[model samples]
Target chain A: MMHLPNHWPYIAAAYGLTIGCSLVLGIGAALRLRRAKTRLAAVESQLRHRESSAS
Target chain B: MRPTPYLLHRYANPGQFLRLARALQPWLSTGAIIFLTVGIVWGLFFAPADWQQGETVRIMYVHVPMAWLASSCYLGLAICGLLSLVWRHPLADLAAIEIGPVGACAAALCLITGSLWGQPMWGTWWVWDARLTSVLVLFFLYLGHIALIRAFDEPARGQRAAAILALAGAIDLPIIKFSVQWWNTLHQPDSITLTGAPTMSMTMLWPLLITTIGFTLGVAAVIFARLSAAIHESRTRQLMARSRLNRSDRSAA
Candidate 1:
């Protein structure tokens, strides 16, 4: 097994911060997409119901 | 010759773009994850450490890619702004708005990682050198774009204002790119040149390239996902408004 370098903590901190920030943004965007899709589906379904009842 | 507007109009439709985005999102996200994992693993464990910087050099695998994405994101934002302003393209505005927050996040990452790298190598956590200062400015430009887009009660007005700001802020991109060369800065010059061979060895360069590609794909996936959400939100608002209007009309009759 390779021994970790003395500067391993700094390396870990840098990569950790970067990956953390990126994941937060990416996952946040994904969740927003899911919510928007659900909202749009609900709206469309409501419109369909209104049209069907009217006819 | 075919006019530019003719081509712009062809791809300006939101429905068509949403369809294309749906097809591309899965591929982009998957590729981003695979490449990022490979690049990080290769850079950290497989690549030889620098004679001077040792394991700290591994930070470059993330820092450089974030820096590149930060700059490229602004460029993309400016181009989308131009399309929004000149063509009044609906999708272009959505793309511009969606890119702002992601670009800001990337710029923030670049700054934070650069500071971390500097602490061990430069004996200092921060510097106001030309390259560093210019990148800070880039980060602010992204923030300004994000702020301007949501400043108004009317979304269209906000978008137009933000589009203008994005175009104006584009002047900073070149300054950030050439700051190390233009000024006597503490920062080193570019290691990778477009016309000349790279300064680093293939082992290091390969990981950098992979990470850069991964960052690009990752950014694209996030932006497209956000853009789709923005479109859907707009459609939902329109549908709700129309339904309310219909109810009001029936009551008025």
Candidate 2:
């Protein structure tokens, strides 16, 4: 494993890409989940209010 | 009920699906992060430099996984589309929709990483070789699915049209896989499946395997999250329509 006159750049590229892709995926999931939770809560509340009025 | 391998019945109802998604979210996110972190570190630092390719081979760690996910996500979308078309399952339609944008993103990642890898190894930024061209077509396939899904006034019509397109695009899967064999190109054939033995050592194999699993799980986790949002949005729309109908009836009374 002695082939490193200019190997670090490749390593950096690989690492940077791995981290960047993971970040995008993780953050995107979190934001979507948050938005879903909010919408679900709002709908649930609306349904509850409608049920109470009907009763 | 026991947690099955595929969790097939857990999604039988929208409510059940929502519950399972909420329960799985944390574990999926954690698994994605941990695997990616370990895989990248191992590949970048510990994997021995290739005897022939030197450090440029490190790009394989990123490029390979993205390519795999790009192709695989389309399959996922196609399967979802089939389920939706056959069963008229709203959840299945939501899944196809949810997976489309993410699949497109994965395709873009594949393209960018492949270009980066190519620049160092192949001496060019862009090439229209069989492998590259097929992957490019896969990207366009994904874009077409996404655009078609959003083009119609009726959401169900859009979903139906998109579903048809996705099933038709399944033809490209084999074409992409066999392009290197059918054409003489700069792109290498499947390293993992090619020849009698893998050309790389154990150190390289471990990281590649780990990264592939990581990327796949990461895509699934994101898709699940997106699906949850889509379900909520659809439900809200239905409830609003029902409420409007109720109001009109009450006024008529």
Candidate 3:
């Protein structure tokens, strides 16, 4: 196995930052999508209820 | 055969785009995770250390791809801006808006990682080099877009203003690309070239390429997911407004 360099901390920091930022952005986008879908569903269901009562 | 206007219109429709995004999201997100895992492992452990830079070379894996996406995303935003302005394509505006935050995030990553890499190599954490400065500008442009988009009372007006800003900011892309060649800078020139073979060896090159592909897929997935959310939000607002109108009409009757 190749020996790890003394500068391993730098390597770890770089990867950590990259992965950290990526996870934040990815999770944030997912949450936004979920919220939007929930809102849309609620609005749609209310519309359906109104239409049925009107009929 | 060229796509007809009807085909373009159909593809640009939010409902059609949402359907396409739903179909592609799973595959894109999964592929991004797989490729990123494989590439990062290979880059960090298996790839040979640079003879000069030693272990610090590992920073290139993340920094390079982030830098690539930072610029590429802006290019995409500019194209979407043009489409929105000239063709009045609502989907283009939506894409531009969604891309702003993602591109800014990528650009910010690039700067941070670049600084980390530079401190050990260049003996300084930051510099006013053309390449670095232009990237900073790119990040600010993204922030400007995000701020402009939310600045107006009417969303349509905000979109129009942001689209114009996106188009104007595109002038920075080429400057960022050719900065090293054009200026005397501590930053090195491009390792990968369009017209000739890459300067990097295969072991280093392969991981970089794989990581780039993974990052690209990840960016695409995020953009699509955000676009879907934006479309849904727009639809919900429209529905709420219509419902209010209907209620007022019934009361009047």
Candidate 4:
């Protein structure tokens, strides 16, 4: 099509790969943090309960 | 203390870092999104095609930024290495752990995107030239950092070893930068240099700059989030271990 530029496929592929990879990595970091925080909160509360019960 | 030392000492603790990172993370991530969107849209649609490479030159928007991030991230890793060794900055090891994987991602993206650009422009999918090889080596170094950081069951041992590796791998930074100039290579010399003006036109330069800023902020946001999580996880582990010890003592009694 006249609308499309030269080497459009390569351009598209390059952008696709870059954006896709960035999104995956970014999302992965967020999820890891979320999981870590959740576990930490649970453990902290448990320990607090243990301490209070012992006292 | 001097201003520099005052600030470093003030913020050296993990608690201070977490507070700062938490406050800054949203702004950095938002800026990354805004800048990246504008840069990409401007680059892909508004910018003129190159006289030499035509439309494929657009790939430079992403490729160039990835290249920059990969190298700069390595520099950051080296700084973490130094901090870990010199002061045993508590955040340094955790920072390195978070950065290693992200740097690896950036480096891998750099290599792949470079290949894509090279294929159409240079008529090859791959080359073993200095610039290319050095980047490949950089990528491997990132992987090696990841492996070493987790290789030991004791987290301190692993973090310390990775710190040393980061410091040593820093020697490659200069080599990568000078590869084109030092030896014959398919890769072109840098168009942009600290002492010289950019060889590129303003239109192309603007988008590239914006996208680069966005990418840098994005990296920071990710690292901050990862660091905060690592700290939380660490604190919980310590408490849990103490709790377990208490439980064992009571059971023995």
True contacts kept of each: 0.89, 0.53, 0.81, 0.77
C-alpha displacement of A30 in model 3, angstroms? 1.7
Q: What are the clash counts of all predictions, listed in order?
A: 0, 0, 0, 0
RMSD of 1: 2.3
Q: Ten residues in a row with the worst lDDT in model 1 chain B?
A: B6-15
Off by over 4 Å in 3: A1-5, B4-7
Model 2 residue A29 CA deviation in Å: 2.3
Ten contiguous residues minimizing lDDT sum, candidate 2 chain B? B3-12
Ranking by DockQ: 1, 3, 4, 2
lDDT of 4 by residue, A1-55 (tens): 2343358878888899999988887888889889988998899888888889999
Q: Model 3: which residue pairs collide? A: none
Predicted chain A of model 2: TM-score relative to the true chain A? 0.75
lDDT of 3 by residue, A16-42 (tens): 989998998889999999999999999
Off by over 4 Å in 1: A1-5, B1-3
Report the candidate with higher TM-score, 2 versus 4.
4
Q: Provide the overall lDDT of each model, using Cα atoms, as 2-decimal numbers.
A: 0.91, 0.81, 0.93, 0.89
Task: State the fraction of real interface contacts model 1 keeps.
Answer: 0.89
lDDT of 3 at B87: 85
Runs off by more than 4 Å, candidate 4: A1-5, B1-3
Tens-digit lDDT track of model 3 for B199-246: 999999999999999999999999999999999999999999999999
TM-scores for the candidates: 0.95, 0.89, 0.95, 0.95
Best by DockQ: 1
